[model samples]
Target chain A: MTTTLGRPGTRPSAARLGLYRAAIELKTFFRERDAVVFTFALPAVILALLGAIFDGVYPGSDVTSAEYLAPSMIAAGIASTTFVNLGTGIATDRDDGTLRRLRGAPMPPSAYVIGKILMALVVTVGETLLLLGIAVVAFDVRLPTDPARWFTFGWVFLLGTTACALAGIAASSLAGSARSAGAVMHLPYLVLAFVSGVFFTPVGALPGPLITLGSLFPLKWMAQGFRSVFLPDSILPQEVVPSWEHGRIALVLAAWCIGGMLLCLTTFRWHGRRGR
Target chain B: MTDTPAVRVRGLRKTYGDTLAVDGVDLDVAAGEVVALLGPNGAGKTSTIEILEGHRDRDAGEVRVLGHDPARAGLDWRTGIGIVTQDGADLTELTVREAVRHFARYYPEPRDPDDAIELVGLTGKADARVRTLSGGQRRRLDVAIGVVGRPRLLFLDEPTTGFDPQARRQFWALIRRLAADEGCTILLSTHYLEEAEALADRVAVIVDGRIVAAGTPATLGGRATARTLVRWADGRQETDDPAALVASLTRRYGGVVPGLTISRPSLEDVYLDLIGDPS
Candidate 1:
């Protein structure tokens, strides 16, 4: 009866609990290799492919099409990691009984959720690195040098990731099964990526109504933040247009985060049907 | 209220839309005692256990576990309790040790994960991923996680429902040790009457949301000293005292009567009768 499965002597501290849950969440995410490929890896590959294909498409445009596409991929990466990755992960966890097991434990609900967000953050970082690496080495895309702009990039990335992740958690509650979650992610992701300028220019280039519609989502604002960092300052002719108003972006992101969390808190079903 | 039973329940009721899942019920289990709740499928055994576990809210009743109403008890109260549910929905990404250690972090005073695994006889599988373990091994791991916190009261809802015979016996032995050595109060719900007979100090037969009979396995449904059926090669007769009948038969036949046997209703028989399912 002597087993090596002994627990640590003390209950893990809140900090330690967060770390452990994060580590486990990462492992669970990686364990589903197919999901990993579809959610994070596929986006990076698509970005690279499109960059290579459109290397010289719109010559003498204020920026090369590839340079324009690179910044947009940052927004795409955020959307992939936060909403799609999170929704599917939560749905699968619910379907698989992992959430119920966690519920039975004495862990705080906030800690459980924090762990999930942390995992999503890890994936977000990886996606950002992939897109940034491609932009730097393959496309000769210049790194933003202004300290102010770099600071703006950091804030935008964090807020964008949080907002998307929260929205994903909310969507997870609506999904009936893990497979459906994955399937449903496809349409929203493709349409939003295209319309939000993750694969093209912003609202001005698209139809007027489409511009208004695309600006409503977090993806458009996220791309604008990246453009503010990478785009030439002179192109933004109008002074103080609030094109990348960090405060407003933060507020909107916060609203989405709170709204998504409330929806998930209200509707997510951990205990699956008994027959299942 | 201070002298309340470890578990005191009265008029417990629950409904799922139109269906009355758990009708009015009453029962109690004292401190440091193990009680088994027994019934067939759809007999409201699980619904009642869920209500007691505080996982599901009740429609109406006074229910308490360890002096506090489970429905209203906060985290402080949940810490003192353990539960081993029927389903094992682990993500299977961590080693056995890692999973147990991770959950141990939640409790205020958890037992050593190693000790918990050892208690359930899964020491060898500690380093193995949960996905690699056999069904019985995974079940033991579930039990390990349930007890890692050294809970004062444990709720095991069909803990052995899917276990094979040998594994079921092993789990029962583990439960006995938990009760005797750790002095943990246990409420086990099972469809298997044999399991109740083996592990419970007292068994409560629940049917249609109410407890139909509650007593020691020997006296359930008047099982103790009930008519003993004596059977011989030529005939069979019911008697109050089988020993006296045997003695008289031995004298008449000068000892070693032909195929003479005494039989009493088994726990299953009595349980079936109590639950209104004699088949």
Candidate 2:
């Protein structure tokens, strides 16, 4: 019964711990057929539906309907996975006691958070690629030819998804139960998306208050950022600032990332039973 | 490990709003010992266990687990301890083997995942999805994850809450194996007296946020020295000397004592008395 494993100071580095956790989280997420289907498939379905009804209706700027909505759809896809999915996933884990058990493990708390964010990023990447594939093949939207535009797409996609993922994790703590996670997360996202014109292109008849309200959320800027990468330069006038506000978009989304990370660090609840 | 106690606590107290959950409780568990915290529901057993497992904050206490304060302990300190709490472990999506291997990577010196799963009698179901397993099987998986790190200490809170009779016995054997084979100190909390008697070298009884009794099962609350019950077919007498009473009963029965029975107060009786229950 004698042994020598009681050296309490021995542990792997935090990065190694986080990598393993991320692998496990992604494995589980990929295996859940329903989660994968809803996360990627639903967005593609909505795009197809939009492409069909708005056939030949170019929002008066010679912009094909599919080309007009491609970046917005992609932005919406990233938002759903990063915000709605991760938020509810975390809240469900809390309600079911998964976070408490993981908190008790030897791994660092940040490792768990990193693992979840990584999973959201993985889902976001897969869904974006799928939507873009559909847009190129089925909707006649041209894939970016220049490597420079591809680079813009990469950073915008990364920053947008990372910021939204952080928001999801931060907001998850406010949800009281798994059942409420979806609604709690979707309230702000849906409101912003509605005003930002995600479901429909608000062409020629832009209102003032909705534009201001949309400006307050990161999604408005994220969609514009992605459009800067995917759409033609002439389409910039449809945006609030009429041109690629690339620096502002990066700054605003980066702020959300910082703010969301702070919120998650300060307020995320590993134990759901704890009182406010 | 030899000189230091596996766990030590004094004047431990915790409160929730206006209610005191654990008030002035002291306890010690030596290394390699399996000490069971025995108490009924709402008796603060879970709260005490949670605090020791470092998942809950204590209001006041001088507590050390393996010579480290759990409240301020770091990952290295946590690596020496294993826990099977009921939450944030919705590993139901993974197979038993996958979950075990996943958790194993979190530890610096983890036991082979296969060995851990087999120890809990789940080797045959290693490929089974955790959600498909029965209640007892899930508990066994919990134990596998709890011990995968070859931890210096283990905290099992109501580990066998939903286990059947056979599963409970198997779980006890597994726990005994951990203490005997691995020299792992165990702090098992449960309301089942039989489980405490079967698994623990010492039992601590907590009731209404206070420890009313703590000792070995045979001597808990003076159970071993309590008055013995001497009985015949139709006669009964409560006496300290059962041998003398048996001798007199034999003589009255003319060399044979019919229906003769001699029994001391059971641990349950002493426990009931200590908790101030009339029955």
What lDDT score belongs to each candidate, Candidate 1 first? 0.80, 0.83
Q: Against the true structure, candidate 2 has what lDDT? A: 0.83
Candidate 1 wrongly placed segments (more than 4 Å)? A1-16, A57-59, A200-205, A233-258, A261-276, B1-4
Give lDDT tens digits, candidate 1, residues A86-149: 8888888888778877766766667778888889999899889888998888887789878988
What local lDDT does model 2 show for residue B6? 82
TM-score of 1: 0.89
For candidate 2 chain B, the 10 contiguous residues with the lowest summed lDDT are B84-93
Chain A only, candidate 1, TM-score: 0.86
The sequence of per-residue lDDT tens digits that candidate 2 reaches over residues B28-47 is 99988999999988899989
- Which docking category, incorrect, acceptable, medium or high, applies to candidate 2? medium
Alpha-carbon shift of residue A63 in model 2 (angstroms): 1.5
The CA lDDT at B190 in model 1 is 92
